[model samples]
Target: MKDCEFFFESKENVEQDGRVILDEYRTHLKDKNTREDINDNELLEKCINIVFEHMKYNRVYIYGIGSSSVVAREFKLRFMRLGLDVDYLAESHSIRMNITRVNQESLVIGISVSGKTEEVIEGLREAKEKGAKTIMLSAARVYEYRSYYDELILIGGLKNLAISDKISPQVPALIVVDILYSHYLNYNNDNKKEKLQMTLEHINYELEE
Candidate 1:
């Protein structure tokens, strides 16, 4: 039998290597302009208006799979805390099954960075057929699926660099989410701030227990 030997780098060397990796990551991110492209004030304002209109009288259903699903869940939680009737389905099967609940009085948001997820496209298509307002967040302008969604919010970044795989795929979508959330906080006077406060307090209380 032969004995196995293991070697570990010193803390100083490990930290130096980690710093180099982080520096490269930051450089790549800086070179990426996806967020800048989405920072169009006019477009974002229009989207805010559309979402607020639908939210006033309808329920919200967000759908996404894989990394996009993470964005959907975060959006749901943030809006829910603001006292909005919002929910999310991250799995293809769940989205298909619960999609029946969507109707004219519903707002469906599909997050697909690549703009080619079949499940996301199908979900938006069905929602449109049911007379629900549909919105899509994607990096690519998928002209083929134009009829499926009422609004298309284009995500910005390196379209050719496959940045999502190297970093977080949901970064661009999350930027839009935060923008919408801020708009809602400023525009709505439905005691949403109070609701947010209460939700935060509840979470803290739970944590302290």
Candidate 2:
């Protein structure tokens, strides 16, 4: 079944070993990836604007565990550079215990590939009960966790991709983040550029010490 899909076709001008060509399989996966991202744009933008608006008057929190937690951490790092106060918790129990702090102005993001991580789902549920805005990023189709989420972004199930894409959730997760980063950059390109420069300089100065 996997053999039937093709993301890149050999051009007449190109000649290479099949092994070398196989190494470029990422090119094929990425073509399919772009289409996957296109389907999520409307929801992604809505969620991004919601987050940006919340940041203006409130706070942003992200929760996840395992490799999905890694994605949450990356999301935090990127947005923090834009000067948003973003907090990422890779521990599920911590999020659940502390979620009482979330309110209507708070935007809570839950990142999990399976969308069934007990701790993650529980934490999101708590945030919802507290009246915070919630977003879920997962590779899984909407499931029981959907009830607790205000918005959902399905990353098109990387499992459907070739063998190379099946092992990691980070691939699709990061793709979505890259798009969100672009949205942030586009929303305030000039101001963000200046602030990013200042932040980089400050970090560098601290590191040099």
TM-score of every model versus the real structure:
0.81, 0.77
Per-candidate local distance difference test: 0.80, 0.76
Candidate with the greatest lDDT versus the true structure: 1
Residue-level lDDT tens digits of model 2 in 1-209 = 44433323543224455555455445535666546753666787898788878878777989988888888999999988888889888885687676767888899989877767888788888888888889988777766667799998876564443233434566667778888888877874658877777788978844344
lDDT for position 94 in model 2:
80
Cα RMSDs, all models: 4.0, 8.3
Best candidate according to TM-score: 1
Instruction: Report clash pairs, candidate 1.
Output: 34-156, 34-157
* Model 1 lDDT per residue over 1-209, tens place: 12322224356677887897576556544654554556767767777777778777878999999989999999999889888888899998988997779999889999988887889899999999999988888878787898998878876654442345445768767877888789878875678788888998988844345
The lDDT of model 1 is 0.80
Model 2: which residue pairs collide?
none
In model 1, where do residues sit more than 4 Å from their true spots?
1-36, 159-164, 205-209
Name the weakest run of 10 consecutive residues (lDDT summed) in model 1. Answer: 1-10
